[model samples]
Target: MRGLGRVLDRREEIEEIIESEHKRVLPKLAEYREKLKGKTAYITAGAAHGHAIIALLKELGIEVQGAAIFHHDPVYDNGDINSDVLSSTVKNYGDVKHYNVCNKQAYELVNILNRLKPDILIARHGGMVIWGAKLGIPTFLMEDEQFGFGYQGILNYAEKVLETFDNIEFTLNLAKHSTMPYTDLILGSSWESSLAKEIKADLLILSVPITYRLVLTCGYVGYNGGLRVAEDIYDRVLDTYR
Candidate 1:
């Protein structure tokens, strides 16, 4: 009985923490939602994070223009058919247009972006950001897989997004000078292999796998993470003059 009592107490403590955090974060999120509402975004990530990001974006009143999952899992470990990532995402966030690509096929992604022309692109991997840059889309590179969980997580996300939007000019300038090396046919005989230029893209690295910049202990796990993402995106879009 004592052990059971302890377990119950711990559970209650956790609940209290959660409730406290919720109260603290919701008002800020509401503020962000007002600022971010109606904005369109295209998301590209792996299975689980893709769904999470979609949900997070919806919470901020952002419209998902489209989403592409790197892979799809037909079955989850829980053995619940309805709980699969794709089904759950649709169920929770409405019927968002989504694609399930097994690999990072740049051409396919580019085609989708061309058709959608979303206001922004959010991708999990660094490589994917280049395509968005080439197409003059503000891109957010989400590196920290674990950063979107709690109250702090969401807030961080919102801040980061706002920052990204605030710096749109840099991205545009980079895009103007950058080129997408697509196919041999596209390159043709005029393409010189020896000719290279120092060109960069306006890519906001949100977390780990930092290439140019260094980031430590950043993530997109909870409420704070969601907010951080929102901020970065807001900033990026605003900067883009979009």
Candidate 2:
């Protein structure tokens, strides 16, 4: 019982740190609100920040027409984001369509974008960004520089690896002994190469330990809050184009 209690306490502490870092990036969203007015935009974001950013954009007078929300999970299910709040939030924006971008086919997204005909696209993950670019739409990406316990969505890979191996000790043993690179081992060769293509991320939000440091490297600007900053950057692009 004592050991369980200790583990729970540590988990709470980590959650607190993540939550705090998430809030810290929110202020930057305010900087570009006004610049977003009048543009019709589509956004892809996770539950936590995605819903909030949508509300903020509405307040700023931007016409957000479609969104693919990666819902904040209620339970730990490797990469499966719950769309509970996200669906409702999109409805609040009056006819704004919401899509579940979690593990869905790319063509579905392309079809949605074609129907929405947004002036710009804002996304929180690599896949959406690539889809947006393929359609010749100006794309903006906003995502934490890393995710899920201070890694590049590593938990997702860990979960998939666990599924593949089907045993805890064996999974760990394979990870320890496998000659394959960790990224390749976890994400597989197909995803590895595709992830490489997604590397030219547009707007990266610094997360955890160095949450406040904003760096704009790789031709992609870095900001504090995840998708909120992406929305801001997308708004500015809208301002320039329209």
The TM-score leader among the candidates is 1
lDDT of 2: 0.52
lDDT of 1 by residue, 180-218 (tens): 653221111112222312222223544334454454665
Q: Residue by residue across 124-193, what tens digits does model 2's lDDT show?
A: 7776676655555556565753432232233332333224324335333443443311111111233243
**Residue 97, candidate 2: alpha-carbon lDDT:** 53
Candidate 2, pairs of clashing residues:
25-224, 25-225
CA-only RMSD, every prediction: 19.3, 22.9
The parts of candidate 1 lying over 4 Å away from their true place are 1-9, 76-83, 181-242
Clashes of 1: 53
